[model samples]
Target: MLIGCSPSYDTSQAQQVEASNKQTLAQAESSLPHKAVVYQVFTRLYGNTNTTNKPWGTIDENGVGKFSDFTDIALKDIKSLGVTHVWYTGVPHHAVINDYTQIGISNDDPDVVKGRAGSPYAVKDYYNVNPDLADNPANRLAEFESLIARTHQNGMKVLIDIVPNHVARNYQSLSAPEGVEDFGFSDDNTVEYAKNNDFYYVIGQDFSVPDAINGYQALGGEAHPLSDGQFKESPAKWTGNGSRLAKPDANDWYETVKINYGVKPDGSYDFPRLPAGFEHKSAAEHYQFWQQQDAKDIPNSWRKFEHIAQYWLAKGVDGFRYDMAEMVPVEFWSYLNSHIKHAKTDAFLLAEVYNPNLYRAYIQQGKMDYLYDKVDLYDTLKAIIHDKKSTAQIAVDQAKVADIEAHMLHFLENHDEQRINSPDFAGTPEAALPAMVVSTLISRSPTLVYFGQDVGEPARENGGFGQATRTSIFDYVGVPAHQRWMNNGKFDGGQSTEQEKALRDYYQRLLNLSHSAPALKGEYQELDTYQRKQNVVGYDNKVFAFSRFSEQQKMLVISNFDQHNGKQFSLTLPQSLLKAWQFNHTETQYMHDVLSQIQVVYPIETQADGTAKLEITLAPLQSMVMVL
Candidate 1:
């Protein structure tokens, strides 16, 4: 269904739709478990205490954080904010500038690496951890396992990245299990497309690194033995971003090579297709279906990744965050993820998928637990906060994905997004408070927060690959705002400023609520539409409201996005909510704002028509969660 083309339903029509929805939602909640809160931390940057943030700096100049830095106190402090899973990004062994030749690790070609510390997505070895993150390079895998054990001991699950769609340009795995060969170990180099080939090839052409263009060169024009403007692939493979050129543009994902999952050059799938009506089937059924199929019919790359996931699961890793999931075939996910579920039924699988059209296919058919809701909810909230869109548009966006709401994960900031406090974005963390509240409590889906997001990290440093608003994932750099909270490895807020401390306190309260609130795991009903129809004097499109309720708890969440004006209005609740909560139509009800430390109560006055209204006054950019 087209999102914007759908007509807005009237109150009676909405009531009928929501009544059915509430029932379906309640049943869904009964079967599913509690909500989750994910804390995403860049492994190399989280514990780095170095103050130096020189552009394109080396590991020595800009020291890297080690696996040992996540001490018990640090894990406990992270758990204090109610995080259920910690995503240690860039944990896998990837291409980098450092030479570990003596330790049996070959030097990576600089022409194919993004920075001194390389792109984590360009994974080199799936069986090992990054050498840069370990105190003893030889003991990196053991150290990472210790970190995993530490995370699990703290009552949190461990999540690591799995870049399934691609690998480093010079992919090599030295730590594969006995008799398990590396990717592309025995492929026919002459053919462009083969059923078992691991990578797509440009036959007869040699791989050439794009020359320096627009004043940009490998390693920022620095000299290195591997930066000789050439790479050694005789039969060039396709670039990670699907660029077919032997010498892809510098702006393309030139550092990585695309993995083939039986997708031919003609865009036809070489593997078996999902039978009709399989999207409605459960993961276990999918697993059973695949188990019945001939093992030789499945693609070789799919089986390789399935073994890789099982290998990590055997080592106690809890879940995976799939990068660029849409680039690969959904059929492969159905095959591999079904195998993962067969091994660990409750394994957490999150995918980075942006296309709205493919949301349901990836979730239901691909067996993904969650997908990033970036194009719809996150974009709408950002526009509303910036005063370029109306809060009412949120209702339209939500309606588009109503059936799959619980599977659409919500987040305000991640490594790919600009910081909330960055000048290019909201310019102040406080300005985004309203949006953050709505993103977290608006659905039953999981909520993710970046490591430095709680303390208002602006990401203002111009480290390496051109000065952009986002934190540099490609370079070795210190995150100053996050370092302040690190307090030189103390894991205490000893050096945080007043504003930063207050912001983190608010995050702690909000995230803890998200983790513990039963109503958040229950059904949702929009209060924005009913309130808009009432046309209260001070209420405008800038203020949005919603209600979430279960048998145990009920809450009304409201937020004011207007940055220049305070709002005074009579917020209304429709009869649907009244029936859901079984509230008396003639008597008044009281609710206290549970979001703030200071106590404040509001009275909901019920009328003869079973509708209720509450007089509320909110400061600019303020939000509230009132509980009954």
Candidate 2:
């Protein structure tokens, strides 16, 4: 889940639009493809070929990628990797290092900005795409729409960031459509919270710069009109990272100011409350709930976001990845998402909500399609890869969230996480093979893979505010490995090493398998439980096993997490479990490996007590899927 640290979840395959105007969730999903593979790439860094990674480099020192970089060939290459959707991060017109004054955009005060290319979450405008990404700044919105059209032509959907919890400290909407009002444009700013106001302010306090610039300077100490150590906010609002200080702590989300969603300083709701059974209500009912209310009664902030979402939908955006979703009130989500679906049914709504206690409310009432399974699955998998967790515990963890598994999007790497080959992480890309296997095939949920993850980008550069473990989301930095695959804009791996090629090939095979395989569609049983019941000796903590079956296909997956190579073991499947699938020594069957294409005949040795023990062998940190 997108913590206040870094947040997001991802998408589903773009489905055919329903013929009928009104449809159920079941109907919308049925027409859509079965599984989703989300490819999340930071838009500004995706095509940058620069290798000069200075610590606090300006845009010139380290080049930035443009919207035009996603050529038809580049997108086709991405689609060929079995991706269903492309999440283009940092697309919105956020605070950045630029002068758009002639185009009606104002300069952002650098004292509050995080990096030269500022945080994407600190959005500066609601109705525009980033001018930094356009070849022609005046036509940026058209360029973005063209990118969306190109993505659709290549059969993939688009998802962009929508930070509802906050906006840039310098919030000014230069291009809002006619009749749309800017946030705080009509506010009664005297009080901390008003039903109609968009921001919560600390009256009588002029905003002061945080004490710790930490020797950091805007534009690397180059002077500019607005880059001086001063900003113009009187009666300061709460900082985006939840700091209430007039001069927020340097560590706070200092670049942005928090939006008020009708919640008072004393933690009381100022907006209309949902009824006790509202979460159980359908979207139509939720929409009708708003329809019944007077326009004046609906909170302005709620309506403002509704207008923002509808504007993007009109521009052909499929859905939004809401940042820091849990920070906003759940009722507002109920309000905002209901209106979003009303505009475009099957709009993919993914949120970064960390509280498991709030999961059901967020999903049921907020009408969210997916949330990040970070705190549970991703964290556990990371621990297992680092030898901090036992593979034996994988089955227990899966069983705990069996009911909500489909709604939890699975991933090992995203913007917030450490790269697999980074020194702080596992320090090797191959170490994630077993973990990736389980993450992609754990359930019927969507799976997300960060760009360059397959080829092992170590992200070793010191990119400004964030650390090296994560590819810096805050700086203008080039990813070393991905740039090799980019191969001077050919969108080919012509310059990649043999190991990098092998890793990408593995990912392609795995992702394509996840999208097509039949056994994965339904009926899961952990073989680890069977091993425990049999008191199996060779099946140790470093090894894990499971089965996925439907009427036609039955598949078994096993992984060995040991450090040393070639650890052979016997994984005993109880006679009862085998009989359930109609397997016997009487019929000799070959078990086919899905990824390797190597086949092995079943060594189904029948026990005197009427059970069968299957012989299985695996390499260190390797995973295999054998078809029955």
Candidate 3:
């Protein structure tokens, strides 16, 4: 399971492997309950209304959002959407403009930052809250603490970003706790590699800023006191994107420096790999394993991050969404995540891991609570939405990950992805209905909804990034659709149009239903074959059907990806599911379409052998979650 050596397998082979993996997972019993619906809100942009939207606008021109913006009403509204957790992206102190040097904060060189507002992944201080998020700059941490308290009071837990892969090019932690040392403060700057050093420095090379003739510049060519295109690292450290060059290309993540987690330039691990088959152990067990047996020596970088995690956990933070977690060693994750679970057993540890081969290792050995299901289900669903792929492919994607399905965090959009309604994506917001349904209902996995995606925020703002298809994570700008829903900080949809309101209503209804039903728990049966049976008509590949059931409750989900036309189809329940569910077939059971609030008193038709066949019709771009 090396990086580029992923093994190739046919469908039958994959299924066989999956069946064995399922046995392994069933033995481990690693599946957590379906209880988390995460709402990912960009901490910097959620409440900003200044729509000047100038590319790389100054903080004053394009006003920054404060922690105060997530008022009780806003948190309650989000909770009402059935969100159990709010992932506040960029809550940590990251590199940015807007001088705080007067308050002993170092002035960030604009030439090295991504925009007037820097990338959230470019963490500057591990122990502090971002000053830009504070109404009164000095009380940033207190404001963030207040936001966390308010969020919990509204019955929602808090999730903040923990960027383990890298830090800003100029890494300094001014507000770090007393007796805490800065990241590179104690590093042997002249060494090419050191097990205890936090960052890897080139032996004799001087840091030189990349030439800006690539049409990228700080402030979009506007001037700042620190926009001199000069940073002072005598022996340049490795760039965050893993560029070892002294002068990293402009296309690379040159604004940040990569963290050295006991890894070497030769691609050799400096830490010990978990003994064979450690995949089935729980975080608590892993913690005990480390405590009982010091199998491998620990690194200082590991100790620093553990302290950082403990610091936030002490401050009432419930979970963390690790940035580019796969980039860091899964061994380090085992150490850090075990420590976290050792402290707070239920603390959620989410990671961004895309390699299919690495999923099991990260989940079992690393003990992560969740991993982004981007490369598998999300990609397939997006392709199906755009008519670039078939619905049949979804079954393959799902089957491939059947073992660890519950740990996969499902989402249609997030900060790094293209917006649903963007031209580069599906041009219609309505297309999201079926995608969201399939993503949320397909498994017992956690569901995530980006803040403005509920109202179809096509991120078309040109904020000096490569492409504007994604909301500008780099610059200072207001999200137009989100602002209308914000209603000038009213946290109400007062200015939203009829279409926007209806779209939002659909989200509110569907997301709330995600938790209200018992269908999300134990067993699931796909109904694709039933819908397209031998004698059925009016159903095409444009439609998908599935069922979710527990002993107490059952749900049959039907979604229409055919956005332009209605569909009339017949459903034929499989004898296998019928036996598995042990449905009471002694009488004709009336099925209630909970989504539409419609009921079929006597099923569409009942066959001689006690099997049920129901003929149903769906509106264009509609999804039905029916209870039987």
For this target, which candidate reaches the highest lDDT against the unseen true structure? 1
Alpha-carbon TM-score of each model against the true structure: 0.95, 0.92, 0.94
**TM-score top scorer:** 1
Tens digit of lDDT per residue, candidate 3, span 313-335? 99999999999998999888888
lDDT of each: 0.88, 0.82, 0.83
Candidate 1 clashes between residue pairs 3 or more apart in a chain or in different chains: none
For model 1, how does the per-residue alpha-carbon lDDT over 504-619 read when each residue is reduced to its tens digit? 99999999998898888877899888777877788798999999998889899999998889999888788889899888665667998889856777889987777888888899
lDDT of 2 by residue, 148-194 (tens): 99999999999998999999988888789888888888988787678
TM-score of 1: 0.95
Clashing residue pairs in candidate 3 are none
Evaluated against the true structure, the overall lDDT of model 2 is: 0.82
Q: What residue runs in model 3 are displaced by over 4 Å at the alpha carbon?
A: 1-34, 293-296, 530-535, 599-604
What TM-score does candidate 3 reach? Answer: 0.94
Task: Report lDDT (Cα) of residue 209, candidate 1.
Answer: 90
Q: Itemize residue pairs with steric clashes in candidate 2.
A: 2-7
lDDT accuracy of residue 246 in candidate 3: 90
| Full candidate order by TM-score, most accurate first | 1, 3, 2
